[model samples]
Target: MTRRITVAGVSKFFYLYENHSNKLKSTLTNLARLRMRKRRKFWALQDLDFTVDQGEVLGIVGRNGSGKSTLLKILSRITVPSKGRIEMFGRVNTLLEVGTGFHPELTGRENVFLNGSILGMSRSEIKSKFDEIVTFAEVEAFLDTPIKHFSSGMFVRLAFSVAAHLEPDILIVDEVLAVGDQQFQMKCLQKMEEAMSQGRTVLFVSHDMRAIRRLCKRVLFLDQGRIVHDGPQEEVIAMYLQSFEDLAHIPFPDSESRQGSGALRFENLALIGSDGVPRDEVAAGSDTILRMRYRCLSHLQNVIFSLTISSLTGQILFRCISTVELDSPFSVSKDGVVDCRFPRLNLNVGGYLVEIEASANGVLADRVREAMRLQVVKGAYYEGALPNRQSQVLVDYSWQINPDGA
Candidate 1:
């Protein structure tokens, strides 16, 4: 297959300013200064080189400020790179934000045609696919309505529909799929799969590792505006997760303020591994534990504590509960600390969350929303098999084979 997209020696840099004057304006002024300060060059992407073959789907994963969005913008021609060159052989459709080229005063119908034209679609071509776009977006009722009046959900639907159905040779998507509900997200994923089957090239950027693993054959990990790792889906994701120590250790002011609410107050939470040492890292498919030490402030019974793991993209992989599956509820008197183990963690390689929630007397007593973040380091665990326990809810499967001399 011929290479459809080539990013050669790409480097993007911006100036981050330092100070601002006014109080309310100070924030805005500071942000502006942050964007334009001299002597402070922030590299959003540097020395990045990659090639996407025709019909290939590539996933870019990184934290905020890692240049994933910048790279997408450069590729989509929304922004020019400070350095480097990108070669594209075909038309590219991008859904970087909810309303990229929309005119607020224009009706949905007009904007669809306008956005489609901007994406290189002819008027006749857009008209031929007009109903399909509206139907997929489910915005028939608001088609004639001005886009400014549409809700965020409606805008997302219409925008995604225009980007997807136009059949551009290369599709570049950022986190726009995250704006809608679960059903719409699933629909978008399905549409991407359909596009893949049709042999279109896809460049996908997402913080959701699951979507990346499910959709892309290759992955790239960026850190501080540089492509740190690029390879197979699993390997790249694993490397990315292992690199989260920089995040977990960044001290938050008054850490106690972030504690979960419950009869028991969380004293400390740390990710520990077989080494039995407190670590900000853990290997995938390894024996790891989220050791959360909590002290009961008062006598409590029939209390349940749970931890939920989610990708940064807001995908929940699995949740662990102490009381339900363990089938044991105990009373805590006065003050004491207990650690719960999440054995053989089977999460795909990515940054995950360890949320703490507790219920007492059949009601929610205390809970912390996304209390802690964890990263799953890649190891030689899966070999070729899928991670364990993923069979139940995360993915569906089927198999086919042709027997010879039947």
Candidate 2:
């Protein structure tokens, strides 16, 4: 057996300039005043070391800005590492972003050949796999259309199909699957599984833990550009979940990653128990409340509050909207608190995330993702033992049996 990929002390640093004028000035100044320029150094990845054996599926998991994308970009040779070295043994293809390696002016059919050529495939080879790619992408009807005219889903489908059918020895996929529809995502996963069966090496990066658990035997947990954990799948995921226990209340104003109109902003979010006590952990099948405090900068009309509960791996378990679920539309003119109470949270024992959003007149006012962290403990959901991890929810039902003769 051979090592398909080896990364030793890999680190990537990027310099951020205050403005384009400053960047030009820094370049003009050369080494004279370079140290005195208004530039900041940011490390997207630092000291990452790992290896993947031939035909092994490796999953990388982390929060946003944890350097998963930076490592993948390095692996794909899109950028050079500032510190260390990486060795890849075979031909590689990457599905990093939507429409990557595609020409907006060219038709889908033309871009397929273009991308294939960029991947080092000969004309004959691309022709041989052309029909298979189109079929897999399910874009034959729009194959002749310009890529710019295709929807995001269509673009990703065709891009993934080309990468998957090119038969590269190593496939590197980022979170691009999130852009496609669920059915197409499943198809892409099946294709990756097929590639793995053929003894092809794979490096998968995704926030979806269920997919990572299903596809990869080994996992790497990254935090702030460093490899925090590298081992079995379950253990790494458990460690990742445990890291969230300390994140009780998150202030939204401090988060620059949020996006929405400036009409309303979430100030803080917390998970509380029935006793109105802020807690990070709650017993399974127990009452839990999600308290969201927001400040309205101006008068709002027909405002609705939306909440989503998701697993740590980014699987959305359930969602509740005040307008849709409760058939209630409310307005806010000042700062206040909104509480979404769950009488008996039926989620199986695990860690989950609460996402908050505010909308008015079908337009988004504000949204904060992963606003609060919640942990579920073992409780009286069942008579004997609680349900397994495979079960998403627990339901209490009585069993009835009658004799045939009766």
Q: How far is candidate 2 from the true structure (C-alpha RMSD, Å)?
A: 15.5
Candidate 2 segments exceeding 4 Å error: 18-35, 149-152, 249-324, 327-406
In candidate 2, the residue pairs with backbone N, CA or C atoms under 3 Å apart (3 or more residues apart, or in different chains) clash, namely none
Highest-scoring model, TM-score: 2
The Cα error of candidate 1 at residue 115, in Å, is 2.3
The residue-by-residue lDDT of candidate 2 on 170-200, one tens digit each, is 8898855543554676777787788889998
lDDT at 3, model 1: 89
On lDDT, the leading prediction is: 2
Q: How many steric overlaps are in each model, in order? A: 7, 0
Candidate 1, RMSD to the unseen true structure: 13.9
TM-score of each: 0.61, 0.63
Cα TM-score of candidate 2: 0.63
